[model samples]
Target: METLKLKKLSFSARLFTRAVAALSVMIFMAACGNKGGDSAPPNTLLGITNCATCATSIPSATAIDVFSAKNATGLAQFANMQLIVSATMFTPGASSAYNLYTGPVAVQGQFIAGTTLVDPAATYGYGNSCTIPAGTYVMQSSTVGQMSLGMLQLPELISTTGVVIRMRVDQGMLYKDATTQQTRMYGSVYITSVNGVPCSSSFSDVFN
Candidate 1:
């Protein structure tokens, strides 16, 4: 009777230990899973799921044309010119992980160059990468061109003034090992409108 009682107590102890171990594993997985929703607002209508790069705030926003650069001469003088940009997106990290990224997430956009400013004898080359500080900018275009980030494609973006996008831009140096550092820019983007419709209230379904 004594031996049987000892065996039963030992089996129960082992079972309890296994249960605790399984629970710990489950908790760890949940912690590492997609926790994007924690930072998002309640009942928010967002088109992108698991949006790791959602903009919390847009401090500085402006419309930029290729002609804005002093070196980009003849761009405004020419018609039907194309302006393309290869941009990477980063989620503004928390205090603990400032300036760090989960991985490389990038987007590309093609625009019909605007012909508003004409600098005949303008200087060449991007003078400084810091000319345009880290902020939100709208790449103004004459026509609605295609913009894509991974599988998400925004085919039609229409506006009278061609306010196609509002993207967060940050400057960095590429080819760190090279003698001269090259400027690289990347950031998150938000499509504020589509087909001349604002993305709010009644036209909100367009985003979905």
Candidate 2:
């Protein structure tokens, strides 16, 4: 089975499971207003590789290669969504294909909610990982049961948005901050428009 990974996300979940109370308090703080802290700063992810042929270990310190790119113009409305990542979150290894780790370790990225898309040629270069649009959906996730099905399991994204799209990824490590210990995630994800139309085939992105 292909690994259905979300490097930073799964680790966040694992951390929460291990320290439910403390994590819960942190979540509460986040909900209340403390957006950034030493543990996990706001909007940071370090996308490095695509989870293909790589060492099975994470490095100690690394810079974030935040994913960025312009949205495909298939759907004109696609340009109004957001795509924000800390440009710091990442994990070490990722499978070129799906290969569940049975634990934390997956490729991931997030689309911001407010960032609008632009003609790559008009402003930034045409293919930089800096213009992924914020989609009109909820989130991207998979259940253990669905992971067994194939490289991807988007029962939720499909059921909610009624469409699917191709995705891209890169593996790397995330540096929360100098004071906080860094956790690795297969950071970097690029999404495609479904049939050149907004919502024609779409998938919600997790907050990177």
Q: Which candidate comes out best when scored by lDDT?
A: 2
Q: Can you write out model 1's per-residue Cα lDDT over 63-175, one digit (the tens) per residue?
A: 11111111122221111111222223333332111112222222222322233211111112312111112222233232222222211222222222233323221221111
- List residue ranges in candidate 1 displaced over 4 A: 1-100, 104-162, 165-179, 185-208
RMSD of 2: 17.1
lDDT of 1 at 33: 41
- For model 1, name the residue pairs that clash: none
Which is the leading candidate under TM-score?
A: 2
Per-residue lDDT of candidate 2, residues 1-208 (tens digit): 1111212233367443533443343234334431333222225433324323212332332322222222222231111111111122332232211121122222234323344433233232333222334354322222111222011222211112423433433222122222232221223333434323332112322222
lDDT (0 to 1) per candidate: 0.23, 0.27
